[model samples]
Every structure is written in C-alpha cells, then in structure tokens.
Target: MRVEQGFQPTPYTEGNPFTTDPVLPNLLKRLLPRDVHEEVYGDLERFGLKVLTTLHDLTSKTSEPRVVQYDQWGRRIDDLQTSEGWRGLKAQMQEEGVIGIPFERKYGEFSRVYGFMKQFIAIGDSDVISCPFAMTDGTSRVLELVGSPAVKRDIFPRLTSRDPSLAFTAGQWMTERPGGSDVSQTETIARPVSNASSPYGPVYRIDGFKWFSSATDSDIAVALARTGPPESGSRGLSLFLIPLRRPLIRPVDAPRPPALTNNIKIHRLKNKFGTKILPTAELSLEGAEGYLLGEVNQGVKFITPVLNITRIHSALTSVGSIRKCLAIATAYSSVRAISGGRQLLKDNVLHVAELARAHLTYRALTHFVFGVVLLLGKTECKVATDDEVLRLRLLTPAVKAFAADKASGVMEECMTMLGGQGYMEESRIGTVLKDAMVEKIWEGTTTVLSLDMVRAAAKPGVLHASASTISNMHQWANTIVSSCPADLVHRLAERLATLRICVTEVISAYTNPSTPLLSRPTLALFAYTTSALYLLEHAIWAHESGEATANTDIEVFRRWIDEGGLLPALQDVRRVKTAGADRTKMDAEIVYGNTSTTQVVDDLPISARL
Candidate 1:
C-alpha cells in the first residue's frame, strides 16, 4: 500500500508465541516429518549418484561452456561453483519445454539411476520458474489417474532396474509466444485428427512455436495448448501428456528416434540474466501428436494442481538463493571491521542484533515452506470440496507473494552488509541477489500475489481457527515487548502495534459480511499483514521462551524473535485487531439496522469462532 523509494527490504523478524498450542507444535513437528526428510535426502543423494554424475559426463565432458551457466551477458559465474547437471539443465530450461538429464538406456538393466530420475523430476522442478513443484504436484495427481500402479508398472516396471543409459527427466513448459505470463493469448492449437490410427481412436495434433521453454530433453512435457479457437481464452486451452517418444508406448524397448515426435524442432536459446542451467529454448511444434490429458477446454484446470506445487518450489528456490546470500552477508560482517573497531555487526550492538535477526528470518520462512509442502501432500489432484479448493486458491498467492517479498529483502540486506566486497565478484551474494531480483517479477509478481491475497481474504471462516490462533499469537509477542530491554522494545512495540491494527482490522473486515466487497483489497492487505506479523511475532515469542529455542535452521525461530526493534513493533498488530473487531460489530449493527449488539458472534471471522 505504501511505496518508499528509500525502502530497503530488511527482514525484521520475530518468533512465534503459539508453541503452547499442542496442535501447532505437533503439526509443525509433523510438518517437517522425519519421513519427509529421509525422502528428500534420499532423493538428493540418489539424484547425484545416479543422474547428476552421468549428467556431468555428458555436458562438461562434451565441452560446452555455454551450458555451464554464465552471467546475463555471457560474463562468468562469480563463485560457489554450479551444481551437477545445473549447467546443461539451465541452457535448455529458459527456452525449451522439456529436457532429459542423465540420458542413458539401461532399458531393463539398471533401475537405480532410472528410479532416481523420477524422484528428481518431482524435486528438481521444486526450484523452478512459476514454482514448477506445484506444477509437478499437480501433474503427479494426473499421473495417479493416468499414472496409476498399473501405469508405473508399465513404465518403470522395476524398482532395481537401473539403466545407466536409460534417461527420464521432468520437462518444463516455459515459452508462450503470445506472451510468457499471458497464457490466455496462446496461439498453439491442438486438433483431434479424423480417422487416426493411434490407440485412442485419434491423436490430438498440436501446431505452435513456443519461445522460452526450459528443462529440455526429458521424458515428458506438461504442455499447454489451445484446443479451441484463438478467441476462447484460458477456457479454450487444454493440457496434453506429450511423451518424447510418441509411437512407442509402455516405456520399454527404447525407440530409435528419441527426438520430440512429429513437428517439434529446437530454435535458438536465449542468453539471459540468471537461472542459467535451465536451458531456455525456442521450439516449433508442427502437427505434434499428443494425447489429451484432461477435459476439453479445461487444460488450465488440470495444470492448476501442479501449478500450486510449482509456486511453492519457486518460493523455496528464492529461499535457497537467499540462503546463499545470508551466508555471505553474515560472513562479511563477522570478518570486516568497521568504524567502531569491531566488525560491522559488532561495531554497534544493534547491527549484531539485526544480523542474528536476518538469519532467523530466513529459517522461519523455510520452515513455513516445508509446512506448506506437508499440507500439499494431503491435498489431492482434484479438490473434492469447496473449502479445499478455496484453501488452495488462497494459499497459492500468499506463498508466492510473501516468499518473493522476503527474498528481495534477504538479498538486499545480505549485499548491504557485505559492503565493498559484496559488490565484488568473490562475495557471491551479488549473484544470488541478481538471480533473485527476477523471481518477484516472474511467476506472478509480488503485487499480483497481494491481489490474490485479497481474493483469499474474501473467503471468511475458511481457516476456522486460524485467525484466532494467530491473534493469540500476537499476545505472545506483546509479552516479549513487555519483557525485553527498555529502549529497543519500545520502538519495536510501536511497529507491532501497527501490525496489530492491520491484523484485527482485516479479521473484522472479512468476518463482517455486512462490509461491502469494494473494500476487500484493503481487507486483503490486512490479512497479509497479519500473516507476516503472525510469523514474525511468533518468532519473537519463541525466542523469549528459550526452553525450546530452535537448535538449527529451526533455531531461526529463536534468532528472529531476538532481532532488535521488531518485538515491540509488533504491538501495533494487536491494536489493529481490536479496531477490526469493533469495525465488524459496527458493520453488523448497520446492516441489521440495530444499535443494540455489543459483539457480533454468528458473523464473526471463522478463525474467531473456531
């Protein structure tokens, strides 16, 4: 709502105060389930051992520096050398729709690497553009439908079947010539063939040139095409499960022609700013034969499932990039001595405080992201109920918007702390910073997410108890502000107070059905503001508690709460809540034309009553 040219994106984080709630703690613990960790770690290890190792041999061994990830202008990678398979992957990621890493053919021999590739498909996309994780998750659901036990058996067919030469990867759908972000204007057309010889009676023929396709040379593509006429918009669009080897089904006996079937051809790749290894491509599909995956005119809907996961991955990618930045910033502050004789962070106690706080801020977001993933696991391909559907729609924007905002600040602060060296090539935060700059713009910009937040805000009582639980959270923050050192806490209290104002007003605004729809945007901002402070304030509360201060990245929860000038700043949030409640009561009174009620119970925000 307020833009400041002087604005510096700093993460003034705080701890959560609601650990007392058995449900939250249990949920959080479960959210970062040990099983999930084992799975993730397992996937990463297998990926490297199987896919990435082979990938290194294929690309760099083949002598392609361009595929190794260069600067926006073809300059050079600063430091923190690129990861395995990252270079070649980046080359095709920005332009081509699909890519295959660790290309090999064990066909029926080696299942280890082949087994790993499928997992890589799920996770590699996690850090992708537009949050490919969400897209994958969505696709995984469809896979379950089309990709059932029967299909998995038909495709992979063996658990230990490792084919060093058998390759499968997650292909990306990036370029939309009508415009990348503007999917409604797509010119790609998929027409059902008449009297076709394929098993499905007829194959849908696709014709269109895609620009900026990423993740090239892979098993399959989650492609978008217009099944109807051009003017039909998103509704006319449909999703097709276009496999690399067409004519050949059941995933065995490796086809001779591995090239993308029919009319698919690669154009030039674009050299861009960051995300280098992703492999940007310009592709032409002339009468490409593809199977229609979902209902006609509802392709976007089918893709929406994976799109959700993709957004979260995109958020996590930003998180990872920022993690790299924080590493440099803290390091620089620790080593670089400043005017006060000690390092910049030590020169002023305040600086040390901020440094610790930023560290925690990152951890807090990361933990929350993992929590979202757990939630995603529970969510299915199709939202069977309205509440579930609404939750997905609302949560998607919040994840994207909030993650991007924090990413920019995290990078900026990390760079600022680094000072001179930060600007240099060696610091490396600059690369992460520049890499992150585009995140907020692509995959639904910050402002775009804010609007989505507003839309989510319109759904009152969805969370049921989320708002109240969050409110109780503010009270915990108030305790920290009350107990912490005098001067700093006072300033923090003021900001907290405003945060409270923003929160309560939002809860009241949305809960009060009598309130007009025109005011929802402001209401939505209040909701987002609440979500921000809820985490921040809770972080502060956790630090003050000390008994269960997070030990590792989990400790970020503790570190954030200790950050200077944020504890008391959260006090304002409570005030906002109070005002919001009052506003709600007032609106109800006016709507019913009665001045008698002191509190509006039935119409209260879902979180309140719950």
Candidate 2:
C-alpha cells in the first residue's frame, strides 16, 4: 500500500521591502517634510519592488568574479571577469541614483534620509554592490570637500552621476600588508614626479602593494601613502587619487587596446568568506601615477570625512542585514508548520516571543542608525546646531560598533526561527548572517571603534553636550510615561535614573583620567542608554500621534527599559566597577581560563564554574 506524501512547506515569498516594512514608512512620515515624503514615496515603493524582483534576480544569477593573469600568447594582460548579472546590478544602482540623491540635495537636509532609506531597502539583496557604492559615496564627499577644481570638474560628476554609463565607482585602497586600520604603519610610498603634468593636481608616482582592495573593478581609487620619514607614522602619510586604468590613446582612426595605469597589476581576487560577489583583491602598484588630494602628510586628517561616511554606511548595512533576516523569518513562520502540522510556527507562543524580542532590538537599532543619518544630512547641509554636531561625532562610532555587535546575534536568532531551513544557504538568511559578520570587522573592529568612541567623547565639551541631549530626551520620555501604566512609569523612572548614573560615570571616566573605564563597556553603556532614550522618544511620538502601531511601539519601549536591553550594559559596568584591583587578573582569567591551583568545581557543570 502506497502512503500519501507528507506535507510540503509553502515557499517563502518576500514583498516590496520598503512598503512591507512596518517601521520605515512611519519613520519617514514623521522625520521628513510632507512634500519631501510625498515626492520620494512613489520612487521608494517602485524601487522596493525592483529590489525584490529585478535586483534579486540579477544577483541570484551571478557568481563571484574571476581573474585571468595572462593571455593565450603568454603576454602579461590581467583580465578581471565579472558576470553580466553583476554588471546589471551596478547599472541599476546608478540609474536609481543610490549614490547621487544626497549629492543632488533636491530634498535639502532630508536628501540623506531619502537616499539612505533606499540604501537600507536595497543593500541586503544588492549582492554586495553596496560595498562599491559606499566607497564611491565617500569618494564623492572627499572630492567635494577637498578636491582641486580640475579633479572635481573631471571626476566628481562621474562619481555622482545617475547615468549608468557616466557613473564611476571608486575604490578605497588603504589596507597594506603592514597596516590594516592602523594607517600609522602604512608603508606605501608616494614620490613627486616633476616631469609629469596633469590638470587634476601635482602628479606623484605611487609604489606599494595593497593587501586588500575592495571594488577592484572601479575606475579610480583613493590611496594612502607615506611621503615623510617612515617613523613619522600617520603624520607622514598623504592621500592620492589614482586612476585605475590608462587613458585610451586612440590614434586618428585606429583602436588601441585597453591597459592598466602605469604598472598596476591585479595580483588575485581574495577568497573571502562573505561578500564574495564583490571584487576584493591584492594589488601591486609599481610607479602608478597618482594626483595629490590634499596637503602632503595630511592623509589621515583628510580621510576623516571618508571614514565617517563609511562608518555610517557600515551601521546602515548592519541593521539592514538584521531587517532582511527578520523579514525572512517572519514570512516563513506564517507557512511553516510544527507539532505534526497541528500548529503554525507563528501561532506558537515560544516562537513568537523570540521573534518579538528580536523585533524589539531591531526597532531600537533602526532608530539609532537613522538618528545618526539625519545628523549627517543636517551637518552636510550646514544646518546642524553645535550640539547636533557634537552628538553626531560621539554617536557615529557608537552606532557602528553597537549595531554591528548586536546584528549577528539577532540574525542568528532569526535564522533559528526558520528552523533547519535557516541553516541552508537556499534560505538566504544564512548568507546574510555571514555577510553581517563582516561589518563588525570592516570599518573597524568593536575594540577599535570603542576606542574611537572614547576619543570622540574625550574631546572638550563633547561628553557634556551629548549627555545634555540624552538628558533632554529622558525628560521628554519621563513626561510621556506618566500617562502609561503605573508599572511602566516606574520602569521608565528606574531606567532613566540608571541612564543618568551611567552618564555620570562615563563623564567622570573621560574627564578624570584617574577613573578607570573600559572602552568597550563605556561604548556599550553609551550606545544602549542613547538607544533606549531614542526608542522611548519614538514610543512617545507614536502614542501622541496615535500611530497605528503605537501599541507595539510602546510595548517594545517597555520591554527595552525593563531588563530587556540596557541590563547587559548596566551589568557590564557593575562588573568592571566591582572588580576593582582584581579587574585585570579576572579579565585575563576569563579570557585564558583560570590557570591557578584553585580547587576545580568538578561536582558542578562546566557552565557553573565561570
């Protein structure tokens, strides 16, 4: 007797990300001017559909790039071959003005909001094309701020062009064998070429090996090289714009073959664990012609704009990855069955609780990243107040580090929500998990970014200004919570007090160097406190405005304040403070395991020993 086949799970289908997203529409409506929101609303909807359809299809069909080192004739002709689908995505991004919207400034201060909202929707499925777009966006900003007239006139237009054929993506070649994030150890050398003449700037011959060059297929690049004594460190480095390909020299009617600029050689594409579709490579620059970007030995100073912009991009990507994973899990849960097909996954209380908790964190981070994006737009438009600028400075690194640090865990939880299918690459959730993992290490590792946060807060008046902003947010939230349930009101008061105490400790640590503070914990405390306040602010607004999701927003805020989010950071701070003289030894023991002669708790489980 043949038995009927078991049930087949329904296929997961994604909707237009922008339209289907529960939080983004309300966010834009609240943050953007009515006219601006109305103007871009249709475009966002159409682009969202395109992202799931055309963009997704294109990326799904493509494979990672491959390199050919030589021609059949044994001549040294390095050829990089990417799939047609990859090229199609690049063209689509250019046509959509993914990098051009902010440069156009059509919406003024809200342009970045509009631009990055599109980026947030598209990045998850862009097949890592956003990697090139980030560097390209940063390059355009650099050019606008410091490029010479000739350079801006020649290249800036291409960088920000909406026309696919005219657009030029840029590579940021900063990493070398000797230095990764530590630009101080950069060994690439740049020498002035007196005989050469260029309209861009004074030409220089750059010589070095770039160990990791993302967007290797780009038209031009900004590289950092030393011009001063080797020991001068970062102070000796200068920024240069290097044309990646030689200008075509076509005689009267003859066709000349294309070539790499100077002696630039494509060594090989990196076999990375994620973002495989992007062309990251090791490059050899033997006397490559480059143009000076700013004053000599000011590379570190000039590249600050690029670093800031890219860090924001990293934060956006981190949050976007989580959103995509959550979307997948949410969509899949409706159809996936459990308990011998008697119940759907979404109806299961335990499963729904995990998704709800993940959603809470996602909501908080969404506000945190977009808050910085809005500040960036205002600052770029020269309309930001002094306090806003200070807040931006302090929050940029915190957002990047915090969002990246949290995204992986949230994504892993989402993956688990999908059960065994989540572990398969076919689900795309696993792929996103791998890609999101890179954001933590991309712009800067959590440790490095935490230190950067400390440096920013250490600046004169920065900590005070930032704390003032959070305090104001807390005051507003304090008033709003008064109308809520008494328990929520109590929780809000307690959390606000904790926030104040955390801020005091942070200020004391930065102001009085004698106060010991771990950079990672300090950054975490700052990020969580600020994020908690932002979530509360959003909840207040939703409640006051009578938004449809007001109940959910209030609940998220409630959970976040009540031992859901800020507890980890508070606990970390307490652990550090109470450790006192034993902090160093305890940290070492935690990392390396206790190597002392202390009696082993063999009777207890391994987990209890810690």
Candidate 3:
C-alpha cells in the first residue's frame, strides 16, 4: 500500500517510509570503536554466508532428501557409521570436511566450513557438529599443538607462518568430561614414563579416560590428568599435549614416546539428539606420553580465559540459531495457505503481521546483543579488577542463558507456524527448533545462569544499576503509547507504575528466608520478568541512541507499531498484570502474531511453527 503518486511530505511523513535521516548509522561510526567485537561479529557473519552457500550447494545436489536418522549415530552418540545412510553421510563429511551433504564445491577448497551453523538447536553436543571445542577448542589450534607451544619451538619456524598457498587448516578436540564444569577433573593419572625408546625425551605416561572428548581427531590435544591423590582435588592435575601426528623432525636420542605415536586411543562416540555436525567423543589414555601447559594443578585457571571467550562465541552461535528460526518461519508464513487456498499469511492477516513483527524483534534483540559485545570489545577490559571480573562473569551467564532460553521458544513457535511442513526437515523450521533447544543446555542452563544473575544482582547499598536503563526504555515505550489515546496512556502508565512497585515488593518478599517453598516458581517467574525487563530495556536503548533501528529497520518498526505494537507492549506490561485495555488491539496481535511487536513481546508467532 505504498504511495506511488502522493504529495511530498515533511519529517515523519506517513507515506515516505525513509523519511528520517539515517543519523543513527553515522552515530554508530563515531560512538563505537574498532575492536574484537566487530571483528568476531564480522567473522561470524562471513561464516554465515559460508554456511548459506554450503546449504545451497546441498539443496542443488539433492536428488533426494538429505536424511538424518537417529540410529545412524551408533549406540554411543558420536558414532555416525550405523548403516548405509550414515556411512554415506560420513564419507560426505570427510569429503566435504563439513556438514551439508551430497557436498559440492560451495567455497571451493574450503569444503563448506560453515555447514554446522544450524546445529544451534541441538539439545547436546551429540549433533552433526557434536564437538565445536574439538575442532576449535574455541581456538584455531588443536590442543596438542597448543598445549606445548613453547616446547615445540623447534618446529615453530615451519608452523610460524600461514600458508600463502591454500586454505587455513584448523583442528578440534574433545576433552571435556561430565563432572568438570570449571576444571579438568583429575580422573586420568599421569606418570613420567621412563625406559621407553621414543622420540619425545622423558615422556610422561597418562592413564584414564576423558568424557565429552570432542574433535578427537584434531591436530593436537590437551588432556588433563592427576599425577597423584585427592589432596590434589585440582592441584595435582596437569594438561598434556597429545598430537595427532609428529611433525617431521630429526631423530633425538631419548626414551619414551613423546608426541602422538599411536598411543592415545578414542574409546567411543556419544549418541545424542541434534547438532549432528559437531563431533563429541570419548577417549581412553593408556600410557600416552605428554607435556604440560602453564603449570600443574593450574589447568583450571589456564582454561578460564579461553572458556569465557568460547562462552561468548557460543552466545553468538545461539544468536545465529535464533536468526535461523526467524528466517525459516518468515519464509514459511508467506508460502503456507489454508482452508480456501489463500495463504495462511495473507488469508489470516494476523499471521502475516506477526511474522513481520517477530522477525524485527529477533533482529533487534540480537542486534543489541551484538552491539553491546562489540562496544565492550573495543575497550580494554583484559586487566580488569575483581569487581569488573565479577561483572563480566555475572553478565556472561545471563547473556548465554537468556538468549538461549528464549531461542528455544522462538524456534518452537517458528516450527509450529509451519503446521505439518515445519515438522519435517524440508522447511528448515525443524532445524531451527532443534538448534534452539540445544542453546538452553549449553554453557549454562537458564536457571543456572539466572541464579548467577541473582547472586551478582544487588551490590552493597544498591538494588538496581539496570533500573535506570529500564526507566529510559519505559519512557520510550511511553512515547509509543502517547500516540494512542492520551487518557489511555496515562491510565496505562499508572497501572505499569503500580505493577512495577508490586513486582518489586513481591521480589523483595520472595528473597526473604521466611518465604515458603510454593513461592519459588512464582518468585522465579517474577524475578525472570524483572531481570528480562532490565535486559530488554538495555536492548531497546542501545538502538534508541541512533546507533541502530534507523533506516530500513525504523520503517519496519514504524509499520509494525502503526499496526499494533502497542498491544504487545501492553501485553508485557500486563504480564506484570498491569491494567488491560483495547482488547481488540491485543486480539489482532494475539490472533495474527506477525509484527516486530510480537517478537519483542513473545519471540515466536504461530505462523513460525507452520
């Protein structure tokens, strides 16, 4: 319904969608700085293209559906050689060195490096790409090559420079175990192997097993083991450099097999639902020789920096999953038709509207997330104080958990929108759902992360640092509402104020030790709402500053609000059960669920599932 012939309008013209100057885009240039956040996001974005190309290649080559059956993964989740179908996939995996099947030269000589982008929905690491850590260890090096960088200085000259000729090769590792969230549990025993004729001088022997061993076939590995007893709860633990192959080297007169020389063995593969791309494995160390990283009993500390980085990257990965859901749901809504051959999209105006709404919401949410991280990365927070570290830790769990938890529902709703088609793999909604489901379990569960937030929430003499952030967002939301009935806006604002007070009171009451057991879930929900509002408020403000939501996005949101953004906005206010008004407005959003408002409000719309 855009105007082809109309009188030129002034600022905020209803007809001209691009009425506002894109000041925000320019503002982003000045305000934000060059940093890792931008770089990493860029990398992820590039990889996403790589993934899309990979998927496209897959689709083109498909004579039949790219089927993935559960049984193909062995009794253990990591095994993908169950039958002809799996073996076929395996050959394709090795041939492509990527996930998308019937593989072709998508990124020639690159082999579709981003094939596992959709694995975000996995419930566990046992998907196609079961072991991201295995391949990257969150680093671009195999653990073995990485573990003893200093010791391997002899061959450093050759490995020093990137190949001027070909694609950069990388490896993965799978060494995580069930019991170790913070540290490498010292279950495996390490002994300095003596009287052994091997290239590595004074090789140490390792015996025990590693669970969650991902990227087991990587170039190198860093396996942790306890040299002694329990007093070394974590103190006696040491990490070793287990390499896949010994780099060509001159013979050295020494006893004990030093580098990877057919000693360490992969025990089995884990079988699980989702993420069939990454490989998570299990391994047994039987007298495998090795070197150490950092210091003994210091494996846990050595891994912290790397672990945090991985968590952040994983957070982005989840964001990618969320994006996948949006794309799949949005596309499906357009094509799906209903009772009278009319598209479910246009036939049911609500669905079409809500899909548009949800797409914007997800984009904005992730954009804020990406923007924040980018801003933070531009600054030097490396040598931060204990307080700063605590803040980072506190925020870390929250971002990972919140993004992931919401993604689950978001993807599911997208899946639901497709009806029968979404249930199958042909549409990609299923993949979106699967990927979103896994985001919750990884890094930290929602509850686990929320607890961390609660623990870090109130500092001495402070109730809410984020409250001001929320207040600004409230002001902006109020702006949107102002365009509605003036009396209605006032009344609604009053109710919102009252609900905030009540919610705060309830939360304070809930925090008291005297609170009963029955209050837990209710309190948790309330706390979640409070926390989410704070986060959401920050998210919104990040854009309002003119750094984002300008240009195309602004028009998108404007169109959405003109339709029914207020309904969803009020719905959130109502979640705290503020006064309800304009049931008709609410119904349009509820029944249709197609606008950006719906996404920020609910994330997933019914059409996404179809």
The candidate maximizing TM-score is 2
lDDT of 3 by residue, 494-554 (tens): 4344435534544353244231222323333332333333333332343454544434443
* Candidate 3 similarity to native, TM-score: 0.58
| Alpha carbon deviation, residue 341, candidate 1 (Å) | 8.4
For all predicted structures, in order, the TM-scores are 0.62, 0.91, 0.58
| Candidate 3, residue 187: how far the Cα is off, in Å | 1.6
lDDT of each: 0.50, 0.83, 0.44
lDDT of 3 at 261: 58
lDDT of 1 at 597: 39
Clashes of each: 92, 0, 59
lDDT of 2 by residue, 426-466 (tens): 88888888877889899899899877877887665676435
Tell me the tens digit of each residue's lDDT in model 1 across 1-610: 4576653333222112122211233324333345543443443444434332443243332211133334578843211223444544433332222212111222221122222223323222222332332243345445545543543543322211233233334454635866767788888888988767444323688888787655444445667888888888887898776665555343456543433445566655557676554445676777888767657888777776555656766666666666656655654555555664534455568777676667655655555454444344335423234443554455566666666777777677777776666687545566556656666766677565655555665554443236334333234334434554454345456554655565455455444534333243443353345344445534444444453642332233333444422344344333443454467676777888664333576568879888
Candidate 2, residue 249: Cα displacement in angstroms equals 11
**TM-score: which is higher, 2 or 3?**
2
